[model samples]
Target chain A: MVSKPPPDATRRSEKSRRAIYAAALSLVGEVGYPRTTVEGIAARAGVGKQTIYRWWPSKADVLLEAFLDLSRQAAQEAGQEPYAIPDTGDLAADLKAVLRLTVDQLLDPRFEAPSRALAAEGLVNEPLGREFVTKLLEPQLQLYVDRLRAAQEAGEVRAGVDCRIALELFVSPLAQRWLQHTGPISYDYTDTLVEYALHGIASQPPRSA
Target chain B: MVSKPPPDATRRSEKSRRAIYAAALSLVGEVGYPRTTVEGIAARAGVGKQTIYRWWPSKADVLLEAFLDLSRQAAQEAGQEPYAIPDTGDLAADLKAVLRLTVDQLLDPRFEAPSRALAAEGLVNEPLGREFVTKLLEPQLQLYVDRLRAAQEAGEVRAGVDCRIALELFVSPLAQRWLQHTGPISYDYTDTLVEYALHGIASQPPRSA
Candidate 1:
């Protein structure tokens, strides 16, 4: 059976939700996780404290959902389907394209400061770290797994390779670089990662004479 | 001219130095970077405040040098040279051995807590992140570069590959898994990373008829 659509009240609630998300992100970026408060978010969002509390259990929950929403909006703005990686039947090309988009997201001023703040806290806070990973990171990583598994079925990837681990070959380098300031990130760098990940670093053995 | 030998006073100074390092590590691990103070370390080590100040300019300096000293001791205990990765002529075997040792070190209790504390701080603290990278991480990574360069000379690794970027294929996955609690880190996982990084995930093509 079809469910009824959300009422006009739901539209007002959606507006309030967007305001709360923007406020939460900006506040966290400015004051960091420790100093960011529910009251502060409520005031900045121009909503009652109970309104925020009614929707989210804590500031962390608010921030998490805010980030998820931000990512969805970014994907949409980039003309990409949210929650899905494109498979153009070219695994390398598909992977490189997705990673280039990720590089843009990572470098985005709107995304960077707040993300770094949250990630910094997560590094020290084990429960929060696990929560963010479960809700935010693991799902994104699973998209890569799906793409890799499809490639395996297509004879592009080795059958025995673990898709989860294989995805890390390209994904983790970019993550480490962003998180640790270990290296410069660019479209070229991500494209090179995809290329190197697909082609062996060792020279191809010579054909039989 | 030959340098003068240290007097009996030098032995006393060395003892105090070790005590200070242990105190610094344990304090930071317990309370985290922000709350850890030079005064706390001095009290814990049973040294005067002036003793800590005379030796270290700030808590950060103390922590950095303490970590460096801890790493040296760990390397010595493992019966490995402090500043070198062993080259056994077989690149995969050598890299695997070093990584296994790294896995152990990452899991070690003494190394885990203080390291996490420092790394957590480094994530949001840019200057500190750059300092630790320059002092600690970049040097270790350079060792891999040197090793990979040797492999290139011996025709094991393909020429025209950037060893710095190549090493990240294996290294960053483990770093991400450990830093983010993304997955279970194990010998098997690291071994798979090395195999994938060397030969890649793509299936081998058929030889020419």
Candidate 2:
């Protein structure tokens, strides 16, 4: 087994890591993905370039981890668990609750600029886009899939529905509005999405209802 | 009333306009929005820079109109009316058919590159993003709104449903999948989205059902 580092070394390392993450986020937000450099992050963080390379592979990796850390901090600050969607036996309520938090995260000044910048680069940079989606986005989407699957087993959702696609009915609308500036986003809007997704917009209710 | 241009002059102008549009789309696709210049577009189109300025006040206007023209041409090629979503009275079928055509358009090689480029720029450029949403994206979304409104009048959609948000239940899923590379887009996928939006994913059907 590897030995634990000395306490002083551990504290120092944690400080440097947080600084690097902050620097990475800010640098990427300011200059965008293409122009953001490892050297720039290191300089901003007051850390050596070797320290960054020792911990992360590249600028993309650095930014990805930075975003991940930022999200965790945001979730913690809001008293939310980062990984699980609460299965409170009311799917619509749970979804709306989470999405409202997402709206908060999306609108946070700390998250907005860096996310927009990275997302812009990701559009044209296919490899980076795929990497971020696979590592970051898909995992988050899987949480919804899991929630929907639980709802399905509980008979809260149609058994025939694909949970993955079902989740998108509410999720993607918020995403599009935020990313494309297609409309205003709020608790009211997201609450409406959840209600619509659960009950649909059809005049005739399902036979089960 | 304004005098008509000489027939030859009209023909010449049309040719120049087509060349300019082609140049603008390809250049933006290659170099992205910030790097693309009116000067470069005119040079590539074999027209004087003044020729472009005579028609469009800015590069953004030229690109916007170019995209509009491209969409009209694509719809025509597909034998679709450019502005209308068919109201066949079977709302689901009509929606599925239109979404299938949209899937084809999204996957079209000609539309993909330039659209991705412009969308990437729009993510970070608020004014440009708002302009495109107002002039291009919103009009297309309004077609769905109109169709949903008709359905409401026909007793096909619930009267209380917000048609704008209702359309996003289907439309935004497709948009997010395409924009983010989060999922594969296909006719089947779009058809499923339409079904889900119309009927919802909930277990109990509404009282009407």
Q: In model 1, what are the clashing residue pairs, if there are any?
A: none
The worst-scoring run of ten residues by lDDT in candidate 1 chain A lies at A200-209
Each prediction's interface RMSD? 2.3, 1.1
Tens digits of per-residue lDDT for model 2, B35-118? 999999999999999999999999999999999999999999999999999999999999999999999999998889999999
lDDT per residue for candidate 1 within B1-209, as digits (tens), equals 97765877788888889999999999998998989999999999999989999988999999989999988988889999987888888888888888988898899989888888888888888898888988889999999999999988998878777999999999999999998899999999998888888778887532210
TM per candidate comes to 0.95, 0.98
State how far residue B38 of model 1 sits from its true place (Å).
1.3
10 residues in a row with least lDDT, candidate 1 chain B: B200-209
Which candidate achieves the best lDDT against the true structure? 2
Which lDDT tens digits does candidate 2 get at residues A137-199?
899999999999999999999889999999999999998899999999999999999888888
